[model samples]
Target: MSINLQKGQKIDLTKGSGGLSRIMVGLGWDEAQPAPQQSSGGFFGLFKSHSQQQIQDIDCDASAILLNANGKLYGREANDCCVYFGNLTHKSGAIRHQGDNLTGAGEGDDEQIMVDLNRVPADVAKIVFVVNIYDANVRGQHFGMIQNAFIRLVNLENNAEICKFNLSENYYGMTGMVVGEIYRYNREWKFNAIGQPVKEASRLQLLLNMYA
Candidate 1:
């Protein structure tokens, strides 16, 4: 019973049921197919047409930013609070990011992040999941060249999908996206579908500054 969430929708992850101890956050995306370039061959009849050569894989990197009770990062200097490709797991061991081209998870998920809700620290209030294109500026790439981008939450115990958020809007100039957030609410964990795009950012660090 998976629910397709709309942007800005919020849902309870652990409620009524005893509590969800483990869950997986899966993200997926594909490079938009370039238009078929069927140029009419002139006198020489030489034509170069279509796909692979034009659209290279857009390296979309996803990261989780851990925020404290006040919804703020530890500090601008405390970089260890963030878990990304460089830092696969947090010191608390509550969150583990399976990043770095680990697309074998299937179901079109390019990357996945596992969370032990029960192990999260008390002071930590939220885990913001963000995705950005690596070296987008240098590569001249943006979300506009991306397609089928989505984020989903799965209950590991039964392999049931809790909810999914699809970023189906036009992101012509966006280089980054704020996919979603998992935060504590009255001692319970909840998920917020924040499918918002960020402009002019070519790296994940810039998106983090939103909280700092």
Candidate 2:
């Protein structure tokens, strides 16, 4: 069974299992339904004006950053060590991003990042998970419009879910969210649910602020 975690809660990654070496972090969300359009009628309100503009999908990008014990990023470049759409894998080959999902459509995990716990370097302490809208401010979109936002960690060995966290709170006017974090605790791995919001223009800026 999977464990559902609450905000600010933390759980051991290998509570009862020690052979777990590979894990997957999955993030998923749904595009908000468009609001009802207003009618501009003419000729005794017989005909209503309509727009030809097409509705775009919500492009929420998922990213991960490997930070050290001092809360600092190992690589200075954005794509060098950070794993995301542009840079799919880390230099050490410990972490890798599956791919970019242009739309938050269909069901299940829209994006996934695989982590080899044993492959990760000793200097790397934490893995921070983040999600942000592609062109939020310019397109007038935010987390308030998204629904069913969630992040989960699964054990790849047995295909069993370890824990999951869902953002159920209202986050109006927020462009990005630091969904969760996986860090080392006394030589054991643990996860923290941090549904914190950010207003940065891009994911790079948000990460800089996080490690700064």
Candidate 3:
């Protein structure tokens, strides 16, 4: 059975039940139904007025960063410590992002990142998972228009779900979220569910700045 974690909760991932090396982090979300469009005196508003425009799809980018023991970026360059759509795999081969999901339109996990716990360097201590709205400000999109956001961890060996955290907090104006963390604790790997919202510009830079 999979464990459902609440915000601020923590759980052991490798302290017992043998050692785990391969894992998958799954992040899923759905765009909220669009609000009813105002009628411009047409049949079912089939023809939108020139001033009215359809809502653009929400593009939530899921990314991860490796942090040192002090909770800071471990790599010399930003790309060295982070993995996202542009950089699919890390140089160490310990982490990889499957791909980018242009729209949060499907069911289940919209994005996934694979992690080899054993392959991660000793210097790295924590892996933080985050999601942010791409070009949110200019596109007029935010987490408020998002629904059913969640993050989960699965054992790739057998495809068994370990734990899941649902982001149920009100994030109307928030543009970025620090969803969770996987870190070393007591010589074992553990997960921390963090549903903190970031009201900043919803950019990866805003998240990296937290580590800096």
Which one is best on TM-score?
Answer: 3
Pairs that clash in candidate 3: none
Please list the C-alpha lDDT of all candidates, in the order they appear: 0.82, 0.83, 0.89
lDDT tens digits by residue: candidate 1, 129-194: 999888888867788887889999999998899999999999987899999999989999999999
Give per-residue CA lDDT, model 2, range 1-212, as digits (tens). 88999999998885667677899999999976644455554222223356534345668999998788888886667764478888899888889999999998989999999999988888889999999988876666678788899999999998899889999998777889999998999988889999988876344566557675
Which is better, 1 or 3, measured by lDDT? Answer: 3
Q: Scored by Cα lDDT, where does model 2 land? A: 0.83
lDDT by residue for model 3 (1-212), tens: 89999999999999884878899999999988755566763322323577665556789999998899999998899878899998999999999999999998889999999999999999999999999999988776788888999999999999999999999888988899999999998789999999999998468888889898
Cα-based RMSD of the predictions, in order? 4.5, 4.5, 3.3
Winning model by lDDT: 3
Poorest 10 consecutive residues by lDDT, candidate 1 = 42-51
**What is the descending lDDT order?**
3, 2, 1
Could you give the candidate ranking by TM-score, starting with the highest? 3, 2, 1
Off by over 4 Å in 3: 39-52
- Give per-residue lDDT, candidate 2, residue 183: 91
Tell me how candidate 1 scores on lDDT.
0.82
